[model samples]
Target chain A: MVPVLLISFIPLVRGIYIGFTDYELGGQISFSGLENYRIMLQDRFFWRSMGVGFLWTTVVTALQISLGLILALLLNQGLRWTSLYSVLMLVPWAMPPIVRGLMWRQIYSPDTGALNLILTQMGLIDAPINWLTSFEWAIPAIIVAGVWGEIPKAALFFLAGLKTIPGSLYEAAELDGASAFRQFRHITLPMMKPIMAAVVSLSFMWNFNAFGLIWILTQGGPGGLTRLPMLAAYEEAFRYGYVGYAAAIGNVMVIIISLFLFFYLRVQLKERTS
Target chain B: MQRLISWILYYKGFIIAGLLAVLIISVYIAGEMAIRLESDEIQTGPLRFLSLAWQEEAVAVVQEITQDWNQAHPEQQVELIQGTWNAVHDYLITGFETGDIPDIFHYESAVIVDFALRGYLADLAPYISDEMRDDILDVNWASVTRPTGAVMGIPFLAESSIILYNLDLINEAGVIAPTNEDPWTWDDLHIAAKKLTKDRDGDGVIDQWGTAMGLRNSANILMNQSIAFGGSFFYYDEQGDIEVRVSKPEKELIGNLARMLFVDKTMSPSGVGKSGAEMIPGFLAGNYAMVVGIGSWARQQVVENAAEGFNWAVMPPLKAVTQNMGVNTQTLSIPRSCKRTAIAMEFIQFLLSSENTTRLAASDWMLPTRQSSLEDPRLQADSTGWKVVTANAQFLSTGPWVGLPGYIEWKSRVANPIFQEFFSQRISLDEAAERIESESNSVLARYQVRGLKW
Candidate 1:
């Protein structure tokens, strides 16, 4: 506990302090209260990236939960191939983020990509599209990759929640002539609410803060279309050597995430109490 | 699990004795390691060299040089550390802050200015050998030195632009070849490119492009080459502070490039999405009649990877209003905290000697900064257009990006995106020039009046 606190808190406190100072790489740090934040407010690149980040987080988290719930339902059906399917679901989660990025890059290649070959054969389009580089398709393409890599985490949580649901309740409902859909609606969803709440909150937080996967895929290019706020902060701190400004960006992100989680949890608690 | 526990209990006495034996052996080994580590600390550790050479040929050259130095100086042997060009700047910055940096490291000239000005690099002037200093070009020396005359690093290899063209295509198109003595102007290349472009199958799409350049991350190349059009990106404003500017001359190269992509339809539009090295395969495959890249890439990629019976030649450096090309030299710097500074300098001097610098630069396919190496017969050979590439050294000059505090930020964030936007025809050339100028000035405004001007 002592070691963990030392490793974690020191950096956290120092970073917060840096947010209020004029800090650069290997340069003198001076107090410049709220100056970095002032610059960030006026910076169009910062605002654009924040917009992109909000869109990415909302789309990716919502899709992950929906797809994960479906997969979990299918796996719980006691099908013959359930074991094999369960193992297969783990593959995306097992591979590291950097490896996933490289794999997707090759798959998105214009001339030799598997995706282009598949699409061409299916007569989807006349010519191959540069998915990652295209202004219109880049966001969607990365969102798909993001969804694919994370579905398994959400699926595992849902699967565990399904097991906790009492089998006796479903058995009692079936006797009352409850259909499969009705039973799921009446018994499964309500019982799964607690787990859903946990997963949704965590997933939202994780998605907003996610950096490695998107960074590997795009590096926020083709005109800053996919530059997430995290990438923006990284550019400020490391690429441009604006440490104080970068730390302020980071502080803003933490506050945003915390505020969101706070309101969401409060609503969930109120509903549970009511 | 319970059965396994019972099974283990049955062999408890023997297991206990075995565990004791293992513990004793571990302690002995630990003691030995501690002694060795203490001895190493007293000896001040091996001089660590973090080399950023990743290509097979480049890595081989670095290893050979390190091996020779290590063998010659057994007492103060050098240790080779591997680093990548991608993460090197951030890695070195943090490493220096934590005092965990290698004794010697390799980096480029433009980016090192930030590090040098921040006082991370040692003043290598005291340790530099007179022969080595005089042999290296003064411009190369200026790259690693501060505005206050503090020498921070030794510059060894320099990269400039080179055009490699398909010989067969040039002849078939009836285009005259350019020579070192008389280079083609921007207009001449534009016309030649139009003639070289072909639609072999009579389809609406062009099957062959006149030339392709990996312009995606080539902001430095674009800015450097823009000098030929009398473009100086940074200047002192009315306040006597460095500021960004994109006048008509600065826009000339980009304007012509946009015309090639959109109006003339000679240069490959796809080239703007890829890197310079990525265009080599297309050049070799006959998709492009010519390709533009660093001089070293000519040797490292085309000369090495070209198919049998496929003939290729290097064209003279392109000229617009002038023949100058911006110098982006690679350097070796010692951290101020290095324990074995003198020994590190010895290795650096040995690695940067006339013959060795030539060997290193030849491996990477760039120009050696040393005059003696440039005069050597090896670089003057006609094979692979070495003469044409070498002749380009005469036009080398200091780029305005040098010693500018916010140059890298402006290039990557402001300039590169505008270049991409215009090249892709999404934004007009005028829009690109405006955005680059305004946004880059805002980026540069964060620096001090005299910051990194060296």
Candidate 2:
């Protein structure tokens, strides 16, 4: 308990303290009293990154949940190759995020990337798309790569949730002349709500703080189109040597995440009580 | 006895807490003793020298030099810790903060001022001999000297940007071959680039680009180009006043660069968001006929990585209004935290001696900073590519604003983004130039207000 408090809580408290000061690496530290926050509020890059973070979280979470649900449902159907499919589905999640990011970076390369080659061979496009370099395509390309890596975990969660849904409920639905679609809508959908909520909230938190994947892929480039808040905070801290300002950005991120988690949990609690 | 047992049980929690406190205190004492014993053991050993020379050849050279030093002075052994260039800066900064800085380390010359100003590096002027100072190149020496005339580091190797081109492609495109004596002008290079850029497969899209212009060092390149155009962002006046001059030449250079990137479209589009080091693959893949602003040290990598039948040659850097190139030097410095400063300086002098410097430079294909090493027969050989590098080094100038405190911020935040935006056509050249000037001035003002000698 002492070690935990010393190692973790001390640094947490120090970081919070530093956020209120004008501290820089190798420079004098003095309390500036809300100066850093004021600058953050006015900084366009901060707001832009926040917007990007929101979009990234929303898009990646929605896609991962949908794809995970589909895969989970297929795997739960007692198919002949269900075991084999499950192992294959876990490959992406098992790989390191940095390695996955680097692989996708090559796959998205404009000249020699696999995506362009496949698209060209399939008669889908006449020209090779600059997936990583284009402003319009960079974020979407990153999202696709992120979803590929995130789906396996989400699928596993839904799979666990599927196990808990009583087979007897589906059997009763089938006896009631309900079609497969009706059964899924009436039985599966309602049964998966709690798991879906957990998955969505957890995925949102993870994707919001996702750094390695996007950093390796783009380093927040193509004119800062993919510059999420985490990347911005990193740049401020390490590159710009604005440690205090970066700490403030981090504190704000925590507050934002907490507020999101708060409302989410509140809703879940209300649902449970009702 | 029964009454005493009941009383003890009633105070059990307090007794447990007291015992726990004693246990923690004892462990702390043991840990402190162990640390002290270990440190005492280390204190009796040799001085530590850290280096960011992780390349195979570079590491071999450093090992050989250190071994020779260790043998000569058995009592003053040197333990060399090798690391990569990417991690060295963070390592040094953290080590400094923790009061664990290595006695000696190699760093990029651009950051010498940053460290020196922070009172991390010791002034090397007193330790360096006059003969040794004279042996080093003027520009190389200037790179390590702080604005206060304190020499903070000793330069080891120097490099500058040069253009690499495929002779076959230049011949095929009917472009004039650029030579060290008669390098092509910016206009001449642009015309050749347009001609060399081809759609060989007739697919209505350019399959082969004329050149790749690396945007990673865009700020330095911009400063070099500005100097070539007879303008500079910062310069020292006769009275030693550091003047900030962002004017017409820099703006014109930006306009030309934007046109080359967007309108001319001769350069590779894939060069966007990639550093100079990262663009080597595209060059090796035959996607580009020429790669501009490639450093002298990258020649080996290019040769090794290029596909079969690939042949390349170096040309003197491009000339605009003048023949100038930006020189970047790698240097070694003894930090102020070093306990054995004299011994560390002695080892540094030995490492940078004529024999060792020549060996390392020859092995790595780098330009030696020492005059005698630069004049070595191996470096002077026509086939070694050092002849062109040395010739270009004659016009070497540390680009204006390199040693500034806010230079890193200005480059990463203002200059690089503006250049990228301009290249992508998100903003016009005029607006980029304006923003670059204003943003750079703001950074400068911030540093000045803090009384930094950047």
Native contacts conserved, per model: 0.54, 0.36
Candidate 1: which stretches are off by over 4 Å? A121-127, A167-186, A260-274, B1-43, B237-239, B293-295, B449-453
Best by lDDT: 1
Local distance difference test scores for all models = 0.84, 0.81
Compose the digit string of candidate 2's lDDT tens values, residues A20-107. Answer: 9998767888999999999888777789899999999999999999999999999999999888999999999999999999899889
Model 2's alpha-carbon lDDT is 0.81
lDDT of 1 by residue, A27-99 (tens): 7899999988898889899999999999999999999999999999999998998889988999999988788
Candidate 2 stretches with Cα past 4 Å from truth are A123-130, A261-274, B1-44, B234-246, B307-309
- Relative to the real complex, the DockQ score for model 1 comes to 0.29
Ten contiguous residues minimizing lDDT sum, candidate 2 chain B: B240-249
RMSD of candidate 2 to the truth, in angstroms, is 3.1
Candidate 1 docks at the CAPRI level of acceptable
lDDT of 1 by residue, B1-454 (tens): 9999998999999988787667666866997888667646734878889998877888999999999998988888888988999889889988877667888999998887878767788888989888998989887887777777788788998887889899999999999988987889888889999999998888667878998888777688887787888887777768867767788888787777777888888998778777787778788888899886545555568877889978888888788888887888889999877767888898999988899998887778788899998888888877777788778788788875688777777788888887777776787777777787778877777665436555
